[model samples]
Target: MTERKYAIYDSETSGPRPRYDQIFQLAGILTDDSFAQVDQLNIRARRLPYVLPGPKALEVTNIDPYSLDSPEHYSPYEFAVEVHETFQRWAPAVFLGYNSIDFDEEIVRQMFWSNLLHPYITNTKGSMRADLLIMMRAYSACQPGAFVIPKNDEGKDSFRLEHIAPANGFENMQAHDALGDIYATAFMAKVCQQASPELWEHLLKLCQPRGCDEILSAPTCKLVTHFGVSETHLVTRLASNPTNPKQVCVFDLSVDPTPYLNLSARQIAERMRTDFRILRTVKTNSQPVLFHEGDKLAPEVTAEVTSGESNARLMAINDHPTFKIRVAEALSIRASEFEAAPHLEAKIYDGFPSRDDERLMREFHEAASWPQRKDIVARLQDSRMKQLGVRILMSEAPQVFDPAYRDKVKRGMLENRLMPPAEADLPWETFASARAGLAQVDDPELRARIETWLDEQEAAAQAVLAA
Candidate 1:
């Protein structure tokens, strides 16, 4: 059997929105097949030129702006190069991170896109990605009482890393720090694996692309998976798609589709306009694991999916052949429409480029030094490709170029509208929203401190306006 290498990583970012936010700190802990520690990476990258750090995010991560400009820190371009190389070394390994699918993965994808590297590099090249948060939830369901459940200030069960880490015997000091979180996540994975080897093995298998395809393509009556914290172990059924098995639609079997089935096609369309979860689709490649109909599940897990009336409704729907066919048809139509309209952001972050573009990008990424890359890029005739090359070169190693070259690169970026325009009002709009959220803070002292920070930010903005 091949060695089962794994890379557990974490990133602390500038803000919540991945589109504009940039990662300032990133850390990873690599382990061999047996979960033995092998190598690690911890880096703090300088903030991107156009990105603004969120005040609350900065406070939580304790990322100082002045320190980000220090010699120790890597520029965004340099950081991208280093990260790409690090993952290449650990290529074909499972990329696992806590709540990474929703947040950290987006940050990484955007970083790669902006830096002209493969955005989904972690998932391609025989590699795969998984979210530890989902695994943890699965473990909790599969092996209840295996790990301690910690409550927060409200006395509600909290699954956040800081609380869960100490509960599972992992040191969690500097809880919000990227390196600390990486260590904690790795240790927690070990603990979960030790406690429930079977479930852990299942999760690991699900992390593989081939494994996901097999499981999703299998015959399933009713399956169980999670949507969010509140909707854990949601029962679903597969809706057929002849071509792309990867784009498998899983209907929420627990939801009563019987009421909607009685409606005409027009009424069903209207209902879809309101709430589309009459059926749900699972992109198996992205989210692989789902408990089969007859799989032995813990009582708590069963309770979550097999609810009282919902279970009965699903059984009824299953029994009615006509109902099942109609519901499937409706879901299939919706899935077809969704597939036709690909997300714009996805195009921007696609890992696979054209053969020619890939070859050039690979060459640029593999180039030994900045000057070598500049030389190769300067020879490119394609304006877009040239712009990408110059952008990466300028950002990654600005010190290598003289003032004139730098000016030309900046002008190119401006002409292409790659950089945010000086007069853009989005930042001010964000500031207003942040200020509104600050009013909800009940802690007088903390609120006062946040207000002071906000004032400084406003002054800085005013200075930019004056400039």
Candidate 2:
């Protein structure tokens, strides 16, 4: 048989914002060099206290509110350390995954970084080797005659790596669980390798794109420049031009030279209210009727149109045909600007994801410690040392020495903000005993000393949470 190839990895994160969220769960199944399963990995990582999971994140995890399981229950960083040190057992000759590019890889890489390990540093040359989503989007043809293939841009049936595996006859158990994620990726990899060998072979050469550059675009980056998400949809790159159905009405006076006759720019803008109609098309909601200064009648003309708002300057018109004509012309010009936007360059294809799934795996390798996250570690260290110093000062318990915040010495919250899964997993009542025990020390110096240790413990716990 051909040399065994590929470790299939999978991950479930707190949300889209990887750096800010936690890697709560992970799964991996190592296959031979040929994408055949050989070994496995599964884990539930601790979360950080500051992680305010978004609605989507919350829905996906459906976290057990009744249970209290914080980083105090386990150590993700220590786990990463162990995993990196023993990479041979689970790592396949080659690695693969479904949507691993953004979700799985990122969760793991960040997990390692948060844990203070460099096992899978992202953005570094030669650090990781995959990004399969791009391959499918660029090379594979979508299911024919499908109207509105879900989550896919034009030229793609569906770019979601998670969906491809199951759609193409790969096994799926529990998604978002670490081990399950791994198995799904492995299974999907096998399916893709067999079904689309040409695409698969080409994808193996891609490299990773670190720091959210390749996975998803934001206001700063653009996607429509590459390919239309659908055949009927127009490509959109402007962040301000996204389609939002919730907007009741939009008045963008920003367009040049009004496009309506006998009406002012303001008046035309008021007419575009969506309380009566809302267009799903990109950028059109921001437009209004063309205002032209036709018969330059009194500049105070007002048109009583749709359902109401404050009786104010929002509906007045100047009746200049040039203004209205200019507005229409302005839209034409703006449309052309959007047309000239830069296309997606090949350089953007930094990672060679192996067709949708592996492409995603390659794109999302969580290889680096989050930028500026070291503060978490620093705070832990500082809290420990400062708590100790303060205890030392109070160690002697001067007869008349009164401090500004001395009350905290006994009754203050004992959380080491650094503990992974910042929120204590145990019920608040369970830790009551531990907290009470920690609070009962009478020796001033001993109390101070204990604070330092507590700080360190909290820090380490927080680190675990972060990992």
Choose the strongest candidate by TM-score: 1
- Tell me the lDDT of model 2 at 39: 67
Q: lDDT of all the models against the reference?
A: 0.67, 0.39
TM-score of each: 0.77, 0.42
Q: Give a tens-digit lDDT track for model 1, residues 1-467.
A: 89888898988887787766778888998998667889999998885543455556766786664565567789888898788779878888889899888788777877777666777777888888888888888776667787887989888778899998888777635688998998888878888888888888777777665666665554443334555442333444545445454555554654666675565544544565576554555666665456554556532333333456666765665676565455456555554565431423334533345667667777877789888888877766545456667766776677678877776655544333223444544522245555666665565666677667657655665454454
lDDT of 2 by residue, 230-317 (tens): 1111111111221222112122221222233345434434443331121112321111111122212102113222222211112322
lDDT of 2: 0.39
Cα displacement (Å) at residue 141, model 2 = 4.0
Which pairs clash in the backbone of model 1?
none
